[model samples]
Target: MLNRKFGYVFLLALLASSAAVGAEYKGPLDVPAKVNTKFAQSNRLTAVAKAGNALVAVGPRGHILVSENSGQSWEQVPVPVSSDLVAVRFVNATHGWAVGHDGVVLHTADAGKSWVKQLDGKQAAAVAEKSFKKAVAEGSEQAKKSQDLVTRFVEEGADKPFLDVLFLNEKEGFVVGAFNNAFRTQDGGKTWEPLFWQIDNPQSYHLYALATHAGELYAAGERGLLLHWDRQRQYFSAITSPYQGSFFGLLDTGKELIAYGLRGNVYATADGAKTWRKIDTPAPDSVVGGALLGAHYALVTVGGRILLNKSDGSGFDVIPASSPMQYASVAAASDHSLVAAGARGVRVETIRDQAIQEK
Candidate 1:
């Protein structure tokens, strides 16, 4: 009987190990129909912003897809290099920056008419080191991790070192990433400075989201590592997060801030970071990212769930978007017209027209 018990235990252990390996292959299982296509097999979507009457979405392997007349139609912009793009912010209808892999930063002055490579992180660090005010590797955890990302994976069909960027305007912005990498630029794309010298455990921290709310910069990363900017010193400091999973992105609802993370991890704070509480999500899969639609509505976007939204009193309702969004991401205009970005370098525009009145 004892031997029988031991055998059962051994089998269970093996099964558990297998499950962990499978979990890392996390994917959008029930992707909406619209984003599923051969050309748009994008993995990590980093940048989605509105430009003029167009919506631009940028992502891995130098993928830039522009949607003219909202997100109803898309066209690919052939980038000069095969770099992974992670984030896009438009200061106005014309000026913007898209940041991504290999320390790459792209800028467009003539709208989407042209793009120029502004600065690479590796190159920026070298330049910063020559300056008298070069900030020494802060010896913080972030600095240590930044060094570990010197080499990146280029596995075919796999997502590589992902990043996130935010711009208060075309000239001043910051881009952050996995391996504790962070860069700041004040003169648009003229030059950049490393926020921290290195990040500890270099490759351990996978940053997924960044946003500025109420004059404070907030960053969220793997295992729920949250950081806030200290304006006086111009650096980031660690803060307590409610979960241990990676935060894909954040939703600023004005009255509340929702810090959404892996596997349905969504935490809300009413009085800023003084306190946080988890909100229940209807979906069971890990949420990769999301954004606000309007004053009383939000989209619970993940890589797989094309469009999930929470109406004022109706709770969570899937968006009526026709396209099946796979490996999806979501953003919203101030007017609440929803724009989703993701793999295949794709973007979709949607709006809540009306709901059917049931008998």
Candidate 2:
């Protein structure tokens, strides 16, 4: 599948060429990931998460790395498929999920040491088809549209990739991706139900991120699309978006919610997204990932800059990287160090105490 997300053009080009090589060639979704003991540390990594005391990061070609002593060092782990992994999240030290290209979803119960495939694009399409059929039979108002979607899903095959995965607990979570594709799992990904029709995305915008704050779940995506899950209604309701650019991720600072994305656009809302105020940031690049670092929030840019929230929460200050490079994701280690994964692989940096100035 060709991902329209920024920074994935190279990956799509590589896949296109591979497909032209031979008819017997297997797609990354079905091919097992190759182990590279010597060069695993240098492979491009897209996302990182803290698994208790351990750190897990994933990236293109199904490369997964685990760091035991914070992010000081990393070791590659075996994965089932070679599909590009875009995002990963851990509910606890032992339970975590990773999702990416080819609609791949992988789960690990033993921290990041091992993983098993929970779903793929082919299976996901089948799930959506089944759900759509039921909706049509029940005479749902959106029946006609649902039927069309099923036909598209069947024709698309396994090309749609899940961009992000979120789990509220070990048993409850959601995965959202290109063209408004979404699914929910209540049994720890044992089974997933199609959730497209439950959201207010009639235009089928690609959902790039999912976040929760104060028990409220929100989704953000292309064209400034923002959605809030109405628990009672059991559907995702649209919220007024402050920017017209794609939002790559969200940050929950415990006190407020931040939606950040393209061209350094960042907005915060303290009243459950009912209102939002823009937060000025120095970096002009897209903010790809963020994490709450102790009392401060850290945001990483696609241009390799790290920005930290001021202690007073008034604004953000840029912290220059030792060796600047494109960064895709960042996470806070148990020891309060910062670990970032991206085009140049994984890097660990300990934020200087003075970087986050006190009010």
Q: Which tens-of-lDDT digit does each residue in 48-166 have in candidate 1?
A: 77787777877666767776666666666655546766677677888877776666777887556567777664565565344213322433544344433333321112233337777
RMSD of each: 12.0, 8.2
lDDT of 2 by residue, 120-198 (tens): 9999988888878888788876645656666887688988889999999999999999988899999999999988778
Q: After superposition, how far is residue 114 of candidate 1 from its true place, in Å?
A: 1.6
- In order, the Cα lDDT scores of the candidates are 0.62, 0.88
Candidate 2 — worst ten consecutive residues by lDDT sum? 1-10
* Quality of model 1 by C-alpha lDDT: 0.62
Off by over 4 Å in 2: 1-24, 357-359
Q: lDDT score of model 2? A: 0.88
Q: Estimate each model's TM-score.
A: 0.73, 0.92
Please report the candidate that would top TM-score against the real structure.
2
